[model samples]
Target: MSIKDIDDIVVHDISKFRPQEDISLDSTKKKIVEKIKLQLKLNNTSIRKLAEKTGMKHPQILRVTSGENYNIETLIRILDALNLEILIKEKDKNSNDQLMNTAAL
Candidate 1:
């Protein structure tokens, strides 16, 4: 079945972004989700419009923005709807992780 046919598919788990402090997105993916939420708020974008634009269910987008777990395909669709993209580059020598951040165009 296609994405629409299986829109309810999901597996919930604790976020890897275990806060180092009271509030933080310590993981790269978590940071990206935070960025998406910020952009959506800045642009006054609604989940309804985003779902329509990306052909994804509202719950799917909610899962992503909530920093729950989401597959790459869902993330890509959301990024496309928000005019955003992920950027990858060599990690700094001092950095402990390889994952990078995203940018909005």
Candidate 2:
């Protein structure tokens, strides 16, 4: 069967599909950027000040936090300067099973 056939047959329940990984990643990235921006605002720090504090270029900081090209190492340094930690956790078993079922469709 063609992809269109699979798409038609598998979409029985719109809500059953788990978010695509890239969508989740983008959401996570946006959240991190917002947190970093908030931290800067709360501290009354400008991008230039943050750059000086983190030893990163101002343009690079702007680009990363603006959802352009993202660099994990640079983001880590910035987050460290802002005293933030990244967390990772696995989904509960039911959620995992649901996602698997959705993907197999």
* Candidate 1 accuracy as TM-score: 0.64
> Clashes in candidate 2: how many?
0
Give the Cα lDDT of each candidate.
Answer: 0.74, 0.81
Determine which window of 10 residues in candidate 2 has minimal summed lDDT.
Answer: 10-19
Clashes of 1: 0
Model 1 lDDT vs. the true structure? 0.74
lDDT of 2: 0.81
Please give the clash total of every predicted structure, in order.
0, 0
lDDT of 2 by residue, 1-105 (tens): 998887787555654355667545666678888999999999998989999999989998998779877678998999898888888798678975775566566
For TM-score, the strongest prediction is 2
Q: Show model 1 residue runs off by greater than 4 Å.
A: 1-26, 97-105
For model 1, residues 1-105, the per-residue Cα lDDT tens digits are 998879977746344343333233446667898899888998799987888889889999899988887888999889988999978797575443323222110
Measured against the true structure, the TM-scores of the candidates, in listed sequence, are 0.64, 0.67
TM-score of 2: 0.67
Q: What is the lDDT of residue 13 in candidate 2?
A: 60
